[model samples]
Target: MKRFAIGDIHGGLKALKQVLERAKVTTQDQLIFLGDYVDGWSDSAAVISFLIELSKTHNCIFIRGNHDDLVHHWLKTDEQNENWLKHGGQSSKDAYAKLTLSEVEEHKKFFSNLENYYIDPENNLFVHAGFANMHGPQNEYEPYMVYWDRTLWETALALDENLKPEDLLYPKRFKLFHEIFIGHTPVTRINQTKPVNAANIWNVDTGAAFKGPLTMLNIDTKEIIQSEPVHQLYPNESGRN
Candidate 1:
C-alpha cells in the first residue's frame, strides 16, 4: 500500500476530488492530510463532512491546522474571532451556517479529534506546520506552535544547500526524524507551485488556498499528482486570494 501526503485543501473540495481521482487512491492506501481542510474556498463545511466520511473508509490521518482550530473555537463557543473571519473563516462561517445544530456538533467533534502531528513507523514526521523544540514536536513547549510555527521550515530553507546532516551546523531537530512533511506556509510564496524539499523537510502546501492546485505526494516514491488550479475550478470565488 502506498502512503500519500496531501497538502492543505483550504475548502477546495472540487480540487480535492480531482486530485484523488487522478491519483486513483484506494482504500488500502494510507492518506496523511496536512490540514487547513476548511476555509478560503466556498465548501468549508462540505469539505469537513467529506473528510469525516473518507476517514471511515480509508486509512487516513488528519492533522489539525490553525484555521481548523479557529473554526473549532467558534463552533464550540459561538464566539467568532475577527482576525479569523478576515482571513478565510468568513467563508467557513457562511458555509457552516447552512448546517443543523447536530451536524455542527458532529463537525466540532471531528475537529476536536484531529491530531497535531503524526509519526510513521519509518520515522517520517507529518505536521500541519513546523514544531520548535530540538527534541521534536512531542517536546514542544507551546503546543499550538505545531499548527502555527514557521521557524522550522524557515530554518531548513536557510541552511546551506551543501550542508550535510552530519555537519555540526545542521540543526539538531532535523536529525530527530528521517524526514519531515509539513503544510501551512505555501510553496507558492517562493514562486513555485509544487511540493518543495529543503534539507529533510518536504513542504506540500502548494497554495491551493490561493492560485495553486491541490497536491498529493507519494511519500515513498516522491511522485506528485495535482488538480487544476483552484481559481479555475471555482471561478466565481476568490479563495484566500
Candidate 2:
C-alpha cells in the first residue's frame, strides 16, 4: 500500500478532487491530509462532506489545522473572533450557514476528532504545523503548537546547505522522526509553488489557500501530484484576503 500526504486544501474542493484523481488514490492506499480543509474559498462545508465520505472507504488520517480549530470552537462555544473571521473564517461560516442540524453535528464531530499529529510505523510524522519545542510530542501542545508552530520548519530551512545531515545539531524533535510532513505554512511564502524539502521536513502546502495549486506527495516514492492554479479554479474568489 502506498502512503500519500496532502497539503492544506482551504475549501478548494475542485482542486482537492483533481489532485486525488490525478494521484489515482485507491482503497489500498493510506491518505494523510495535513489539514486546513476548510476556509479561504466558498465550499468549506462541501470539502468537509467529501472528506467524511472519503474516510468511509479509505484509510484516512485527518490532522487538525488552525482553521479547523477555529470552526470547531465557533460551533461548540458559539464564540467568534474578529481575527479568525478576517482570516478566511468568514468563508467557512458562510459555507456552513445552510447545513441541517445533523449535518452540523457531524461536521463538529469530524473536526473534534481530528488528530493533532500522526506518526506512522515508519516513524514519519504528519502534522498540520510543526512543533515549537525541540522536545518530543506532548499532550499539552494542542490548538497552538500543533496547528501554528513554525519553528520546526524554520529550523529545517535555516540549516546550512553545506552541512551534511550528520554534521548538524538537529533538534531532538527532528531526530525522533525519519521524516516530517507539514502544511499550514505554504511553500509559496518562499516564492515556490511546489512541495519543498528542507532537511527531512517536507512542506507540501503549495498555497491553495491563496493562489497556488493543491499538492499531494507520495511519502514512499516522493512522487508529487498537483492541481491547476487554485485561483484559476475560482476566479471570483477573494481567498484568505
Candidate 3:
C-alpha cells in the first residue's frame, strides 16, 4: 500500500480536496496528516469534519500540531483567547457556533480523538513540531520536539522507553527507516517567497495559506504531488470602491 504524509492544512479545505484528488488517494492508501489542520485558510471546521470522515475510510494518523493544541484548549476551556483566535482556532469555533449541542459534542469527540504523534512499523515517525527525550540515555522525546527544535533532536532520539540510548537513534532492532516527516515550519510562505527546506527532514507545508500549494508526499516514492491555489475572484471596479 502506498502511504502518504501530508503537511499542515490550516483550514485550507479546498486545497486539501484538490490535492487529494490530484494524488488519487483512495481508501487503499494510508494518509498521515502532519498537524496544524486549522489556522491559515477559512475552513477549519470543514477540514476537521472531512478528516474525521477520511479517518474512517483510510488508515489515517492525525498528529497534533501546536496550533491544534491551542484549538483543543479552547474547546475544553471555552475561553476565546487571542492566542486561540489568531491561529485558526477561531475559524473553527465560528464554524461550530451555529451547531446544536449534540453536533458540538460530536465535533468535540473528533478533536479529542486526535493523536500527538505516530511511529510506523518501518520505524519512520511523523510529528507536528517534534519530540523531546525526557529520561532515557538518549532521552528520546516525542514528535512535538521536532516542530520547535533541531539541535536537541539528536539527544532526544538518544533514549528510549527505558530512558537509555539504545546505541541507535532509532533502534536497529526496529530496522532501518529512511526519514522523519514533519510540518509547522513552512518551506515557503506568502511573506517570504524564499523557502527553508529541511534536508534531513521533509517539511511539507508548502505555504498553502499564503496561497502556495497543498503538498503530499508518496512515502514509497518520495514524490510530491501538489495542488495550485484556487484564486478568489474579486469584483472589477469601473469607478466603485
Top TM-score prediction, candidate number: 1
Report the lDDT tens digits of candidate 3 across residue range 1-241.
7899898777778778988999898888999998888655657777888888888788888877777767767777887777666555556777667667776677678777777667788767677665445332123444445445444333333335453324445443222234567677665533532223332345676676555667888877888888764223111211001
lDDT, candidate 1, 108-225, per-residue tens = 9999999999999999999999998888999988889999999999998899988888899989999999999999999999999999999899999999999999999999999999
Query: Ten-residue segment with the worst summed lDDT in candidate 3?
Result: 232-241
Q: Rank the candidates by TM-score, best first.
A: 1, 2, 3
- lDDT of every predicted structure (CA atoms): 0.95, 0.90, 0.64
Whole-model alpha-carbon lDDT for candidate 1: 0.95
Query: What does candidate 2's lDDT look like per residue over 1-241, in tens digits?
Result: 9899999999999999999999998999999999999989998999999999999999999999999998999999889999999999999999999899999999999998999999999888899898876565564445478898888888889877776656656456678789999999998999999999998899999999998999999999999999999888989988985
Candidate 1: the clashing residue pairs are: none
TM-scores for all candidates: the values are 0.99, 0.96, 0.76
TM-score, structure 2 vs. true: 0.96
Please list the residue runs of candidate 3 whose C-alpha ends up more than 4 Å from where it truly belongs after superposition. 134-177, 189-199, 230-241
State the local distance difference test value for candidate 2. Answer: 0.90
C-alpha lDDT (0 to 100) for residue 10 of candidate 1: 95
